[model samples]
Target: MFKKLKDGVNSLKKKVEEKTGIKEEEIRPEEIPETQETDEKPIDKDSDVKDKKTSFKNKAKKFIKERKVILSEDDVEDPISDFKFDLIENDVAFDVAEKIGEDVKKDLVGQEIKWREDVGKIVNESLRNSILNIFTSEFEFNRYIKETDKPVVIIFVGTNGVGKTTTIAKMAKMLRDKDYKTVLANGDTFRAGAMEQIEKHGEKLDLKVIKHQEGSDPAAVIYDAVEFAQANNYDIVLGDTAGRMHTDVNLMDQIKKIKRVVDPNLVFFVDEAVAGSDAVERAREFDEAVDIDASILTKIDADVSGGAAISISYATKNPIIFVGTGQSYDDLRKFDPEWFVEEIVG
Candidate 1:
């Protein structure tokens, strides 16, 4: 997935190795046998400790508590700066890249590298931590669903062609498996086939879709859906709104009015992972317009740079509840920060 990031980290490791022939211990454990005396004497008590650093081949190598090589900021400053540029070139937002760089630099500068530990391990591990820190939230949608009040209302908002409708359908399937009685609400009345698109998904999933005729009030549609959920004891209501650009003031105001009318428990900002920084900016704007509860990023499997996935949560200050990995209903997975980092670095 993050082939670019992986390669960049690898390149940085090699550069650090080449730039500063910093120091490897000449006294390896294998050279010192258990009972046999070797010509290589132990570090002289009278000699300068800085003159000799020891490395060992023993499986339990952490016994030595001494810091052999201390990394200076100058040693990694240029290499880490180049890596930050690589992150930006890969579609990661500039602010996010800066944060990652600063975190990595702060972590690596003056750090201790133990004996038998190569610079590559220390460098890559630091990079991994810096990248993972950008994903600040560990929000779980399943917990929210299980604990939140029944008939919970979630309104999905985003620009057109970002898979908002399909994502709603996917979420409905997920809720149904959990034995939650769910209903689909078509709040999008602007587009010509908007009603049919959601209806088709509703029919396939065997869920009821509530809607109004074309050019009707969107807020009214979702209001009616909420009413229906209350009467029928539905566990949740998934409402789909007409996709519109952030520049469209009227449409943005329409969403605001719907939020006011329904007072949805959650507002989901849906967009594609492939949209990169553009998706992050859109999520920010949407969050400003209507406070977002979480985000759902589609086409994650197709995204190579991982910019949207890395930047959206940090930008919006809202958790990414789910990521659409593929086209199937089963492809939706809860966002896990640890797992995502592993996928990239492991």
Candidate 2:
């Protein structure tokens, strides 16, 4: 996982080391004093003082030059520029890549380093810090659910073919494992078989699903589900909305209506991680419309670059609640940014 991103960062570090010439180890003076000399030629008393002074000066200059190497902005400019291109090629959003490059450049410039290994270590750590800063919010979904009020309503929204529906089913299974009394609500009335898809999951999970006929009011469907949960003491309600792109004004309006009616405790924006920057843009649009509480990314196990996860969290300033790693109902895992950083940076 994240193999491509790791390789790109490692390559950038190597370039920085090469461009700055920090890999060379300087020879030390071996504690030689002005009076010490190994030369076989006899030292002439008249010129001995002058010769020793000149040798000491040369040693002092070499020691200072080697020990106090400082990297300048111009030294790292080309390497950082190349890193930005690598990021964009690996599906990082152009704006995000630019921001990350500038941050790394700032962190590296004018930094003092000892000769030998410090240069590479500084560059690598700086890149790691830059990426870690992108994951601003650290969230744990199960912890939040355990503390929040019962009968919590969570609406899931995303564009088409992004696995929004399956994600809801996985979430239902996850809640069941936690021993929460959960119910599924099918608000995706526009899709021809959307109702059936969620219904099938309900049957498999042995949970009740509230639904209205296709083309019926979706908001009412979720509202009814919430009411049922309240009456039955269900712990949570996971609502599925019709998948629609940001460009689809009508569907976007309908989604907004669902949020308004349900007043869900949380709104989760689901997207496939493979979509990369496309997913980042979509996440921003969805959050703006409905004010999403968190984000859920699917197909993470198959993602190569892993830029979408970083970009989405940075773009929305919202925590990444979960990521779908596999096809099984139990494959959903809480998103941990620290673990992600370790995998991508180490």
Instruction: Report lDDT per candidate.
Output: 0.82, 0.85
lDDT of 1 by residue, 116-223 (tens): 568887877887898677777667788888899888999999999898998999999989988999999999999999988898888899999999999999999999
User: Where is the poorest 10-residue window by lDDT in model 1?
Assistant: 54-63
TM-score of predicted structure 2: 0.86
Best by lDDT: 2
Q: Score residue 177 of candidate 2 by CA lDDT.
A: 83
Q: Model 2, which residues run further than 4 Å from truth?
A: 24-65
Q: lDDT of model 1 at residue 331?
A: 82
Worst 10 residues of 2 by lDDT: 34-43
- Per-model TM against the reference: 0.85, 0.86
